[model samples]
Target chain A: MTQLSIDQIQAGDELPTLSVDVTPTTVVLGALASRDWRPMHHDKDFAVNRNGTRDIFLNTPNQAAWFERYVTDWTGATGRLGKMQFRMRDSVFPGDTMVIRGKVTNVSTDDSGCAWADLDLAMTVNDKITTSCKARVAVPSGSGDNPWKRRGSDWQPNGPGNSNAKANGS
Target chain B: MIEIPNEVGDWIGQPRYEEDTEFDVERGYIHTTCSSVENGNPLFWDDKVANELTDGPIAPPTMLSVWFRPHHWAPGRKKQAQPLQIHFDLKEKLGLPEAIMTDNTMTFGEPVRPGDRLKTRQILRSVSEPKTTKLGQGRFWEIEVEYTNQRGEMVGIESYTGFGYRRGA
Candidate 1:
């Protein structure tokens, strides 16, 4: 997979849309993989009768995996996640088509020299947003620069002007 | 609006529980997780591709919490500890029947690879006053969970916020 360098990205860049036809198996497997044994995510009767949802729905970590996959698929293997925050506005039940779309909000290098991209992303079902996400990812500043290799003080996820602090109001 | 008792509010800033995962991060588990999402990222499946990035194939960063999820049944254990105990505690303390997560933020530190064992610490961060929403009358609360590898290296932090309410209240 070809990795995108910082130079190749700019604010306002839109990522290719990703769409998935969610099914009962999709929901159950996601919950199973995450080790989430919550009945609402797997047991349809428990979900509809007890939880009062239309059907078994995707759990939080399941949705999180989806968002991470959507971003990394675009950034390629070299891309490393620094921070990801998302708000769930509604449930994504089986039979719904979840479409993910993203836009680059900003791209900048921190004082530590870690190049970063801030993205605004959303997962929509049938044109209605189920979750909205903001992500901070590290991309190569130039050829051969690997963000994953950075550690200790070099990687500051909550550094100044970083979206994490702003999102948490800290 | 339902009143959040002072005792419930006091949970804020208190570290709830710290527990180690039941098993080590396994390559097969990673494969199943990737398959569940239909994620084709080579880093998760291809050892060569992963070795280029880290020591070996790494678990997806989003799977940070999956490691600590309490098993449904253990041979000797009569009752399992509920996952996210603080959330359930709040629900019971406040007497809310329904709960839903509103938002979540995760920050990654180290790459979680096969054989790495993880531990997590949950802390209550904040709680909001009861308010009315379309769903019902509820309050919002935030909890932060810190994940660390067996080597004591930081893995990630998950800041989760949820709402607990009485249906149609």
Candidate 2:
């Protein structure tokens, strides 16, 4: 995978969308792989009687992992996950399609000259957002060096140089 | 109207778990997670591609929760605490037995590599004042899980927010 250079990226640049069929297997496998063996994620009866959901649903950790994958897949090999935060609006149930889409909300270089992409992502189903997220990823400046190899990186979610600092309101 | 409990504040600023966690991060498990999510990124499983980045394949940041899962079923294994005990506790107090996640946030440090043994400590950072929303009557709480490697290096930190509420009064 090619690293996106500073010039190759810009605010509002929409990343390719990913659509996943949220099947019972999809929901259950995601839960088990994450070691989240919660009954709500696997047992339909428990989910219906105990949780009051339509069917066994995906767990929170499973959703968080998917958000990480969505962003990193866009950042390429030279990039590192900076920070990821999101709000869960609705439950992701089996048979729902989890369509993930993201855009470059901001781009900046930290003190060390590492390129960072601030992404705003929404995982939606049935025309409603199930989760909304903001993430930061340090990408290659296309300067031929890995950003993670820098002696130090000041890539905090709301650090001084981060363009989203004020927006993060931290 | 929602009534906030007094003990909810007692948990704030307190360590949630009794002990820390230490275990070797496994590659096979990493692969299982990647495949489960249909994440085919070579960064997670391809050492050849990883050599281009670091020493070897690294676990996906999404696998953060997988490391702490209790054994599926073991005769003598300590019963793991409820995933969201505080939320459940508060819900039971407010007559709201169902709780859901309002959001999740996490910050990663260096990449976690296969074979790297790591430890983690869980802390209850804060709990919100009782509030009423369209969903139900309850509160929101944040839990922070910090990870440290066998080398005593910080691996990553996960901050989670859970909203516990009953559907209606």
Candidate 3:
């Protein structure tokens, strides 16, 4: 895997664009993986009749996970995810081709010497932005060990910790 | 005509998850999820590439909420009640038959690995006043789900927001 150091990354850098040919199978796969059995995500009848939606739509968590994969795919395994906030504007139905595009908007370093990049991403289909993604991701500092290992090496099961996107450190 | 229940405040800060502790995050499932999104990234499926970060491959950071789901065969699975849903009567009182997702924010805690047992709890964070929008008279509901591994390490947090609108215009 190619590791991108902080110095090598700069603001205004355009990340690769990904195009997805969404289908009923992809919609179901995402819902099944997330364990979301909401009829709106599976049962077409329930979605149209009961929920008043056109068809089975992608759940919010499933879309968030897709954005998460997009960022990490560029940052590699060493990339530590700090925070992500995205808004779903419209529903994404099966048989829609979603084109995802993103760009590095800003870069900064925390007091701990970890480099963080802020990105703006969007999912577009039929010339409409269905979801808008804004995120801050931790990346390699170009020197020393990866920040996550240096900070959170100990994995405790009983310890009370939060992984919410609101907090700076997980 | 919809308002948050008077007693709903009491349920905040409570553990929101049901009884199951084991996570179903396996490589096969992860691959399917990644593929479904059209992401053929190596880290999500390539053990050799991911092994460099940890002893084994890890699930996607955004996939945190995926692990806290209830099983299919469980009773009342069709209407699986989440923590806040079980404790607070917000939706029922709203009389809203339709739910629309508006926003989401997630924080990554520890790296979720294969075979990791996750313990989750949902806490009611806050609810907004009934406001008028194009959809109808609705209030925004937000809740936080804190997840920890079996070893007690914080895995991650996911907060979901939605608008429950009246059944008909």
RMSD of 3: 4.1
User: Per-residue CA lDDT of candidate 3, range A29-64, in tens?
Assistant: 889877787778988999898877789988877888
How many clashes in each structure? 0, 0, 18
- For this target, which candidate reaches the highest TM-score against the unseen true structure? 1
Question: What TM-score goes with each of the models?
Answer: 0.95, 0.88, 0.86
lDDT of 1 by residue, B1-169 (tens): 5577888777789877888888999988789989988889988888898888766778998898898888899899987777888989899888888898999999988888899988888999998877788878888999999888887878888999999888888
lDDT of 3 by residue, B47-155 (tens): 7877766556878778777777656566556764553353235677657666676888777767778888887777777777776666667777887777777667677
Clashing pairs in 1: none
Q: Rank by lDDT, highest first.
A: 1, 2, 3
Alpha-carbon deviation at A65 in model 2, angstroms: 2.4
DockQ for all candidate structures vs. native: 0.56, 0.48, 0.51
**Against the true structure, whose DockQ is highest?**
1
Worst 10 residues of 1 chain B by lDDT: B1-10
Estimate candidate 3's alpha-carbon lDDT, on a 0 to 1 scale. 0.72
Strongest candidate by lDDT:
1
lDDT of each: 0.87, 0.73, 0.72
Indicate the residue-level lDDT of A169 in model 2: 15
CAPRI verdict (incorrect, acceptable, medium, high) for model 2: acceptable
Model 1 Cα lDDT, one tens digit per residue, A1-170: 76998999999999999999999999999999999998999999999977778999999999999999999998998888889899999899999999999999999998878898999999999899999999989988897789888777677776565534222212
**Ten contiguous residues minimizing lDDT sum, candidate 3 chain B:** B80-89
